[model samples]
Target: MIKFELKDLEVFYGDFQALKGIDMKIPANEITAFIGPSGCGKTTFLKCLNRMNDLVEGCRVYGQVTLDGEDIYNDYDVNLLRKRVGMVFQKPLPFKMSIYDNIAFGPRTHGIRSKSALDEIVEQSLTQATLWDEVKDRLNMDALSFSGGQQQRICIARALAVRPEVLLMDEPTSALDPISTGKIEEVVMELKKKYSIVIVTHNMQQAVRISDKTAFFLLGEVIEFGDTEKLFSVPKDKRTEEYITGRFG
Candidate 1:
């Protein structure tokens, strides 16, 4: 099943085109990583998946992007669509509320009122995020009290609480230590069974380690895309080989 389809997708910040007629199909319950050098529109293309770029002034998108075979850009509620397609940023931005409240915020806003129901959802989300045992007894504490990695996991739990079908992560492990990065990689691997994950990462090693499919982007164009093993070991594109072998970024 195709979870997302981008057809002739182009994005612009005013007159400057960031993406140039890109097309791709994201499969259901798998992890797809976007990798490229800086300013290559990897993040720009990721933002269009959930319409996150619309918040930027004068940013416009031209092309068809569909989620679950539905045109997300046409006659659809952005708020509801976001709930179905959750996003995690480069940094973890937890609410000022307690740890439990942080995870419960989305469910509450989406009309889950009962305490028992919220508790169940919170537990499930935290477990899925791989932060349950670490903070299980301290649910009422401040989210700020945790370390950077823990905070990121809390943010992931918050995204999961809403039961999103697609999870979009932009450099999710960029700021954490190696151990934290490993933990996140483990959680991401686990998440692919239940949710389709699309990630943008500059860390080629992490991308190779975690993703089943990889898309190589260069200068706002998709240079190549294939299974992780084939793309990393025997790239069809010379540019991909050069980028992967550190000959040139």
Candidate 2:
């Protein structure tokens, strides 16, 4: 099942073209990793999925980007689209409020006012992100007080709280320690059972470990995209092989 389909996608930040002719079908209930060097269109492409790039001034997108057969950029309600597709950033940006409030924020914004319902969402979201056990009793504590890794998981939980069908993670564990990275990887893997996950990662090994499919982007184009194992072990494109072998970015 295809969760997202992009055809002839191009993104321009004023006169500078950030992405050119991107075409890909992201599968449902799987982790798809976009791997490339800095300045490649990986993050730009990720942002397009949920129309996050629309927030940028002078950023224009031309082409078709559909989510579950609906045009996300054509007459779609941007706020609702965002609720259906959540995003987590590179850094752990927990709100200054309590942990419970952070998780309940989205639901509250969506008009879920029942205290019991909000409590359930907070617990379930945290559990899904694999942080419930550690912070179940600390729900009222300030979310910023946690360690970096825990903070990242809290961010993930906050994204999940809205009951999003798709989750976009941008280098979600890049700032964490190895142990925290491993924990986030495990949580992401588990999430694929219920959510279609798209991640932009500079860490190729992390991509290999968590993603089912990998898209290798270079110079604003996808050089290769296929099964994670096949793409890494036997790349069809020479540029992909070189990038994977550390010959060049």
Candidate 3:
């Protein structure tokens, strides 16, 4: 099933065109990686998934971006859109509160008021992000006490607390050590059974390792997209081959 479908999508930051007329389909229950040089609109397009770009001043999006066959930009409530499509960023940004509070924040915002209900969500989200065992006994401790990687997982748990259908990760492991990166990758692989995932990564090798499908972007356009193995072995576009082979970004 298709989770997200984009047609003739364009994004403009003031007078500068970030994403040109583009089209793509993101399948449900799979991981899709967007890879390219910096400023190639990989992150920009990721933001469009949940209308995060809407917060940017003078930012405008054109064309169609649908979630589960419904146009999210046309008539959906912005806040609810975010609840359905959660995001995890490059750096781990945990709220100053305890781990339990960080996970409970989303459920509370959505009107889930029962303490037991919040407790279940907190535990489940942390478990889903693969951080429960490490911090189960320290749920009341400040979230900032953990290392960078643990903090990222906490952010992921926070995102999952809202029961988002799609998870958008923008270089989520870029700041972590090798071991931490591996852990995040494993968690993401396990998550594909339930949530559609779109990841933006400058690390092509990481993309090849985890993503079921890969999309190569350049100058705000998708140059090629296909199964990870086939696309890497025999990319249809010269630019894709160049980027993958380290010939150029």
Candidate 4:
């Protein structure tokens, strides 16, 4: 099933065009990776899925982006859209609060007030992110006290608390060490059972390892998009082949 469809999408920051007429369908219940070099608009395109680009000053978007058959830009409430599409950034960004509070924050914002309800959400979210067993006894501890990888998993649990249908990750493993990155990659592959995911990554190996679908972008355009193995093994576009072979980025 197609969870999101972008039709002739274009984005601009002042006079610079960031995304140029992009059109693609993001599948449901799978991980779709956006891969490209720095400044290639892969990150810019990821931001468009949840309208995160709106935070940028002087930024403008043109074209239609639909979520679950509804026009996200036209019919959906920005706040509601965000609730359905949660994001995790490159670095761990937990709130300066207890681990329990960090996971409960999203549910609280969505009007879940009961203490028992919040507790259940926190536990469930953390378990889903595969961090509950490790941090189960430390619910009251400060979130920042954990290592970088643990903190990133905390952020994932926080996003899961909102009951989001889609997860937008921007280089989620970029800041972690090899062990932590492996943990995060495992978690991401496990997450697609219930939620659709879109990830922006410079790590081509990571993309191939976890993503079912791959989209390669260059200079604000998608050069190739298809199944991960096919795209990497037998790219039709010269640019994609070159990029995959490490000849040029």
RMSD of each: 0.7, 0.6, 0.7, 0.7
TM-score of each: 0.99, 0.99, 0.99, 0.99
* Model 2 residue 154 distance off true place after TM-score fit, in angstroms: 0.5
Q: Which regions of candidate 2 fall more than 4 Å away from where they truly are? A: none
Most accurate candidate by lDDT:
2
Better of 3 and 4 by lDDT: 3
Please, what are the lDDT tens digits per residue for candidate 1 over residues 1-249? 889999999888989999999999998999999999999999999899889998999999999999988999999899899999999999988999899999999999899999999999999999998999999999999999999999999999999999999999999999999999999999999999999999999899999999999999999899999898899999999999999999887
Clashing pairs in 4: none
Residue pairs clashing, model 2? none
- Ten residues in sequence with the least summed lDDT for candidate 2: 46-55
Return the candidate ranking by lDDT, descending.
2, 3, 1, 4
Residue by residue across 69-178, what tens digits does model 3's lDDT show? 99999989989999999999998999999999999999999999999999999999999999999999999999999999999999999999999999999999999999
Q: Model 2: what TM-score?
A: 0.99
Residue 26 in model 2: lDDT? 98
Cα RMSD for predicted model 2: 0.6
- Candidate 2: lDDT of 51? 89
Per-residue lDDT, model 2, residue 191, is 97
> Which residue runs does candidate 3 get wrong by more than 4 Å?
none
